[model samples]
Target: MILDAKQNEKPAKLTIKFNTDKGTIYLEVPCDIPDYGLQESIEKIIEAKCILDNNSNEGLNDLYIVEDKSGNLSIMTLTEYINYRKSIRQDILLLFNHD
Candidate 1:
């Protein structure tokens, strides 16, 4: 298999913004997040954190994901993007621990 220059470079990361009247959240996410359904995963995180957000962070329509590279966008509301981070971190740990 051969990959062209465009394909070789990973698609631009998706930026998850939790914009709200109170404040805003800015997060950059890798486009090719392995084994993780982007929208669904984010929704789960948001639902999980609904209770944790005692102060009501997410506004009526303030959470969305934007891809600068390809101009793709998705809407979701996750209080914390922990699942993705944990999955990627765990993978990294295993990769480096192989000694």
Candidate 2:
């Protein structure tokens, strides 16, 4: 999973994405103000969602939540999730182009 943030005139846009064997999941969030407070809140919300969905006991650090399992698994916020999905799509396109 990955999380990315962009700043615009109107609001701050955040996207989250994850890759799974089934496919991908994404989430996007737009905030009126791009402040640390808002960012922290958003991160917490995303962490909670990830915990609930994955049924894992983990904690959030920086922009992502670390899975305590013995795997390179990471969860992202909703917004980050969306951006990650987009990134994956772009990678697929690049791969096909090279082929």
Candidate 3:
């Protein structure tokens, strides 16, 4: 997955893109964020997904904690999680280079 965010005169926008068997999925989250907000936002996003998926332990591995809950679970592969993290980090670095 690739995550990128840019801030203009208006609200900041975060874009996350990942490839799947079906195709690539993209999500754009807009907010007014500062430099330090990236990590928190990323964590929150992942955690929310985990919760929404009823905390699937299958593919989470070391990325997050799996909890006991009732519902269907969809887990992200380790490689996908790692790639997502890398993308988030890259986006943060990009912010530093921006004016």
Task: Summarize candidate 1's per-residue lDDT along 13-58 as a digit string, tens digits.
Answer: 6665555444444545666755545665566446434533445534
Model 2, 13-78: lDDT tens digits are 465655443334443444443486456555655555555556443432223433213422355644
- For candidate 2, the per-residue lDDT at 43 reads 67
Tell me how far the alpha carbon of residue 59 in candidate 3 is from the true structure, in angstroms, after superposition. Answer: 9.4
State the number of backbone clashes in model 1.
Answer: 0
Residues 1-99, model 3: lDDT tens digits: 234344334435565664433333333444544556555555645654544456445543332211113322223344755565687678867987995
Cα lDDT, model 3, residue 88: 66
TM-score of 1: 0.31
The predictions' CA RMSDs to the true structure, in order, are 9.6, 13.1, 14.1
In model 2, the clashing pairs are 15-79, 15-80, 16-79, 16-80, 16-81, 16-82, 17-80, 17-81, 27-78, 27-82
The TM-score values for the models, in the order shown, are: 0.31, 0.31, 0.28
lDDT values, one for every candidate? 0.48, 0.49, 0.46
Off by over 4 Å in 2: 1-71
